[model samples]
Target: MGKATGFMEIEREETIERDPNERIKDWKEYSTPFSDDMMKRQGARCMDCGTPFCHIGMEIDGATSGCPVYNLIPEWNDLVYKEQWKEALDRLLKTNNFPEFTGRVCPAPCEGSCTVAISEPAVAIKNIEQAIIDKGFEEGWITPRIPQIRTGKKIAIIGSGPAGLAAADQLNQAGHTVTVYEKADRAGGLLTYGIPNMKLDKDVVARRVKLLEDEGVNFIVNTEIGKDVTGDELKNSNDAVILCTGAQKHRNLPIEGREAKGIHYAMDYLTISTKNLLDKKINNEGLDAAGKDVIVIGGGDTGADCIATALRQGAKSITQFGKHPQLPVKRGSENMWPAYPQVFSLEYAHKEAKAKFGEDVRQYSIQTKKFVMDENGELESLHTIEMKKTRDENGIFVFEEIPGTEKVWPAQLVFIAIGFEGAEDAIIKEFSVSATSKKIDAEYGDFRTNVDGVFAAGDSRRGQSLIVWAINEGREVAHQVDGYLMGESALPSVVNA
Candidate 1:
């Protein structure tokens, strides 16, 4: 370890962020750069544990114990402390295909599993990772690596999200002719539209997409499989196809007055706002929340993104609803070290709401009873009831409405960010693939669909999950595809590692 007593000598320091009030004025990224010295100090906080659970990603009680991408966290932290940033970048990229994307958007499960976190704060692995990749870009170290020889085997990836991109990157590096098809007008499916620009700037996505394009991966935008092109056509055109179409089907709140005009899906709202922002439009063309009382349903990252987006759009007031009770501020014993903890913490949007409105703007353990509509079928307010979880005769927990807790709140705009159910069924049907529920039926390890020579990965194969897991699945699927094509594969597997 660099400086054997470095962990004892240095206190953990987080990356500085732009002022909330100032940052809320624009959609640009709010994170400011850290000095090289500050970064080294933060890197020094890594104890570099003997076990190093930070890189030993495994499941514990159905939750991710560490980073899904299996990033070489300690190795890079030591490199950063030694001021070997270029070497740090190399280690960071060994397992992760796109550190840039994960560095910005990942929830940092690695920190939760850090051995140092058993006592003090976890090492700032995410920030240190971001620093390494950012330096690599500034030094012009990141560039396309074109393959020397072509395998002459053509492959089709059906989505342009993290999983699809990672798979394409691996397959292309192995000298396969890879082409990605994105139904959206642009590539980088969720990265381009699902996430807010403040969290992950679209330019960053475009930059990586460009790099992949230059690396001999072809991306076809606005061309969807099963619609623009048929499954038979894809089978005829390519030697094999990997479906990475993400789980984008938004969950709905079917309640009274559901037909109200102001009710909108969170993805639709976020996507439109981003599209307008990219187009340089002064107005979001009715998707803007200016001078509106916005109520976001669901207390998740998507809800947080909606609140932040609304704040940028000048929403007069915002409130988010959570069906579950608030978690304890500290981790409970049941969720001990190395397990992804469920604890209460303020997210960026919550902090922004507190700064702007003088309140946290979140209500826990509440259920939306119905949407109240005014004249002309416009959403005027929301009716809600407090809920308490209780066991039924079957000993199964279910939400029970607490009597005398019914209330109404002014909500001209409502966003349902309750998460996704699965991928679009139309796309699933296009390949005549077997499906379990809304998700494509693909083996977790193999990522192969029931249809021969067809595969699935990412949110479409697994349910909706983190960007890191999607990237991991993509990399894994690419290896399997290579094995199927070449009869012997050299691509690495995160699962095997």
Candidate 2:
């Protein structure tokens, strides 16, 4: 939908990042914005393939294949290429409520499924998207659109993360009275605290929250649903209740010495670090990795964020352990086109750590055996063993430790970034919502629970997933809730798209 032959003429160029050595001194956004001309050039590279899979929004081989929100990517790309900035912004906002958040933090599965990616670098869709929204805000084009009429329906959404915020935005726009509840001091759940500021600035999240507030969405912070307000009370007062509490039950390593004093969960560490930064505390609060040998267990984005956080805190040394083998440099046979590529690439955190430490800190194909503690019960070091991946008799993949490959690494501090399990049990039991061991019992499209007038969405319903998927569910649930309340719904659903 962009230039007819632009894909053959233009090359892909990503947004430039700040110098790692200098950026490690303070907490600030790492990536710099692209020029207007560069953004247009990048947008022009979108091939007008008859079947555009970039917005397919489905899973393939257990990996996300495209934009889960079903963004009008080709339309926006064409608009951007033609310098139709306002139209591009309209198309972007049509599906995504918060492009600023997704633009910065989302892994961008759309790019992986781009048709151009089959033979060449994919179109710079993410950069063009961020540019469009950022420009829209800069030009004062984005303003709160207060609903003209109220449906007299009250909806209470638990959790202030991406999913909750998206649902709130949709419901509020549909003329429903929406109140978002956050247990933390702020409104944005994962966006405000779980994620580090350097990756997504708190001001950015605050801006969206302020917009939502201006648009008639009420936010009640520092209020626990089951404790501060009972589930029965909430359900009786509100016309409907949507649980977007997210999957916050973190997974833990149960090895020996796991209860060491210095060991902490990655979410706790990140939340405290962000709180301290926001509070402007003179002395470091919570777990500080400064001048200490830090070891992070587990892999993925959380582990990388731990490395970056420790680097900023002036850690003496850092190491990360992952049980899985390193991904291939290019897409393997099993991970083909249109599916998210499983390949080796350095993220922002990895680049920063490598620039500072003169090497990558990730140690793959390794399993932690036990955490060694000092006499005071503080973390001292950890023992690990190299593991080899093999197929068992039933064709199940397993990691077998190699004999004589045991080693010890000094670690004064340890952070477990092993990911989350599911929604906390307390919330489920308090609401009497049916749930399995992992997620809330709710269908994908319907999003309705066994309880009348109650619904569930996002991670709490689907288990741990991407921010885009959460937003998709949030939008979809809003549609279902609107239909339940009004007997019909005009809201758009990405699932139907």
Q: Evaluated with TM-score, which candidate comes out highest?
A: 2
Q: Estimate each model's TM-score.
A: 0.98, 0.99
- Decoy 2 TM-score against native: 0.99
Best by lDDT: 2
Q: Write the per-residue lDDT of candidate 2 for residues 1-497, one digit (tens) a residue.
A: 89999999999997799999999998999998779999889988998899999999999989998999999999999999999999999999999999999998999999999999998999998888899999999999999999999999999999999999999999999999999999999899999998899999999999999999999999999999888999999999999999999999999899999988888999899988888899888454448998999998988898899899999999999999889999999999888999999999999999999999999899999999999899989889999999999999999998899999999999989999988999999889989999997699999999999999999999999999999998999999999999999998999985544
lDDT of 1 at 122: 85
lDDT of all predictions, in order shown? 0.90, 0.93
Taking every candidate in turn, the Cα RMSD to the unseen true structure, in Å, is 1.3, 1.0
Off by over 4 Å in 2: 282-286
Off by over 4 Å in 1: 282-285, 390-396
Cα shift from native, residue 3, model 2 (Å): 1.5
Worst 10-residue lDDT window for candidate 1 reads: 279-288
Per-residue CA lDDT of candidate 1, range 91-183, in tens?
A: 988899899899898998899999888888888888988888889988999988989999999999999999999999999999999999998
Model 2: how far residue 217 lies from native, Å: 0.4
Clashes of each: 0, 0
Scanning candidate 2 in windows of ten residues, the lowest lDDT window is 278-287
